[model samples]
Target chain A: MEREVNAYKCRKCGTLHYPFRMVCKNCRANDYFEFDIEPLPKRGKLLTFTFIHNLPAQFEVARLGLGIVELENGIRVTGQVDIEDPTLGMDVVGNVEVVRHDTYDDRYGFVFRAA
Target chain B: MRDVYIIGIGITTFTRLEYPLSEIAAYASMGALKDAGVTDVDYVLVANMGSARINNQSALASAVVDTLSLTPAGAVRIENGPASGASAIKEGFMAVASGMHDTVLVVGAERMREVNNLEATDFVATLTHPMAEYIYGVTLPGHAAMFTRLYMEKYGVTERHLAMVGVKNQNNAMLNKDAHLHQKITMDGILDSPEAFTNNPWVAEPIRFFDCCPVSDGGAALILASKEVAEASGKPMIRITGIGQATDTLAVHERPEPTDLMAVRIAAQRAYEMAGITAADIDVAELHDAFTILEIAESEEVGFFEKGTGHLALERGETAIDGKMPINPSGGLKGKGHPVGATGVAQVHEIVVQLRGDAGERQVKDARTGLACNFGGFGNNVVVSTYARED
Candidate 1:
């Protein structure tokens, strides 16, 4: 089973927030509706990226590529980017993928690739 | 409110301390008490982060008070992420300024070296938003790297400008006996030479190894008193003139603009307004430079230079010890070391030393006014303070 990326829209302000927010930062509304964004375009523009060489000793990789992606819906999310030479303003696509396998379980999250 | 002054200050060497956490706080507190020539204080405030998580100890203030034999004096602990040190001083200042206490002791300490570097990194990462940032494995360096990349693209800052900051601060650290990084780093060694890539590898892209502060264990203390007690101490009167604190969105991505440190700007404006001073009035400053990029960004945010111009000022040598405005003359966290809880207090300790003409080689000449910015949680919580030498 693949995990899907999710976002919540504030009922009062019509603002979208990822990972779910309790209240609308813009409108101070307490109500929100869950929105499934699975069919939405996985394409996004890369704002910035980094090659993280030092990581907590959970996985065995020497380095990981991380970046912030601004989706077409204007919501930004941080995830692993599977590209070597990441440049500013590069178009990328997001997919639900397994990031790492810790001692206890296989951790899964969003990963981006060059579109 | 009454006037509050710092009568005494103390600090332990910024390095791997072998003693227990309580002992570290007590050592610095005893030095402060001896300096003030006072055997007892009306209250004690301990500033610490991760004492409970990293050291497996809670009620740290209670243990410290007993360790220093300062029993019967009110004791409390202040934890405000990386800004805990100055936050404690603010509490002490309020106690004295409110006339609730004539004398208050504030101590900031941390035992980060108790855990290894990976654990230490994870420990610090806890400050990030659990659901948004930390759940995705966003470390502080990773955040700084992304910020640096964006700042560079926006302001035309280059790798050379960042290296200059590293070179200047590490050289300054060589003069500070209490500083953590003693070795002087050069542009050729870290950036210019062919072997530089191997010598100074990237921990996070765009932010090399030298651009980051080392994890350290240390403690710092300050004695805050009212005018009467301050006068009796017979020491130079350094007034705690202004204090400003502000907060921003807990998640970095939630911010309107990732590049602008709005919290720092608001906090500094409040502090300057309270002090009745402008950026030009400050002779010296200690900025939170947990990463090299922060020093430049904070310099701009704090009004030292126009936005997108701090790196240019670095090119002009305007921020050196002998420049128009000397910043981080005590080497800052970049070189002085960051013990999380102790960094903010140590910044004030260096400023007080500069105001008293006690900083041996790194002193800014005739520094009458100083500012310290203690940034917490990647600009989520920030505290800005101003101090003036009152002769």
Candidate 2:
């Protein structure tokens, strides 16, 4: 099965949200678990990107490329950009991947690459 | 609401101090109390960020109050990310303005140097959205770098502009006796020299070493009182005429426009409205320039310049100590050092000193009105305060 990033859709308003929230931002009327899980678009345009040499201790690499991408549906998400050379508004594609590891478990998020 | 005035102010050197966190806080408070010629306050608010995590201390307010022997006064610890200091002051203002407390001692202190560099960065990053930004290994500098890229693209702000702010503030720190980075920095040495690359390497792309603030341990204290108490003290009436605070979305990606800091804009607007003054009325300002780019961005957001034109003003030497609009004359967070919790209060401390004409070398001439903007948590929360000195 192919892995994909998930976004939450408000059942009442059809408003999509990333990382899931208890209430719909648009409608503001949501009960517990009153949202549907929807897969986020893998294709997007890199809005802004940064190569950071300073990372948390968990990230052992010398430098990490990160960016905010505007998806095809107009939703923006922060993700790790694997593209060696990233330009603003450049087309990109992403997949659900392990971004970091805590003391015991791995965390999964979108990792983008040049399209 | 009744008016609130700053009767006394004190601060320890914004550098690493080999003292306990509570002592750091108490030391500053003592100076404030001495300056006010009062040994007691009706309340105490301690602002700190990393005492529990880095310094292995907790219930910080209790310790500080006890150390200062201001016991039995209502005490609370305020943790509002980097804006903790000003947030604490805001509460103090409310207490006094509402006639609940006659006098409130607000102290902003931090001991971030107790931990190593990576550890300090990690702790600060904890303020970011957990599942979204933090798990992805996002740090503040990382966020600033990404934001800087966008601002540069949209507003034409360059690396040179960022370096100019760095050089200006760091050199300004040389005049600030209590500032952290007292060493003088020049554009030539940091940017134009042959070995400038190594001298100012990129910590985050587009954010070089000089672009960021040093992690220091220090404290700043302010005593807020009513008009009666302030007038009785016989000091320059540095009244906090305007106070405004606003919060943005916790996740930066959630904002409608990534480049716009709606919180800062809204907060400053509210402050200007409350004070019944425009940006032009402000004679001096101390902005939260944790990063160099922030100085320029906030200058625009706080209505100092037209949007996208702050850097142009900087190039015209408009933000210098004697310029039309002086900014970060105390070196700001960039050079004075960012003791997290202490920064917001320290910014106000500089404004108070400036308004009173106590800042000898870096005083803005004939400064009567001043402003301080304390930003928190990647622009998610911010506080803007305006003050006036009535002689």
Which candidate number has the best lDDT? 2
The TM-scores of chain A alone, one per candidate, are 0.83, 0.94
Question: What shift in Å separates residue B108 of candidate 2 from its native position after superposition?
Answer: 0.3
**Which candidate number maximizes DockQ?**
2
lDDT of 2 by residue, B268-387 (tens): 999999999999999999999999989999999999999999999999999999999999999999999999999999999999999999999999999999999999999999999999
lDDT of residue B351 for candidate 1: 91
Error of 2 at B321 (Å): 0.5
Candidate 2, superposed: residue stretches over 4 Å from native = none
Per-model clash counts, in order, read: 0, 0
For every candidate in turn, the CA RMSD to the true structure comes to 1.9, 0.9
lDDT of 2 at A75: 86
Model 1: per-residue Cα lDDT over B22-107, one tens digit each? 99999988888888889999999999999999999999999999999989999999999998998998899999999999999999
Model 2: which docking level applies? high
**Against the hidden true structure, what lDDT does model 2 obtain?**
0.93
| Poorly placed runs, candidate 1 (over 4 Å) | A30-41, A100-107
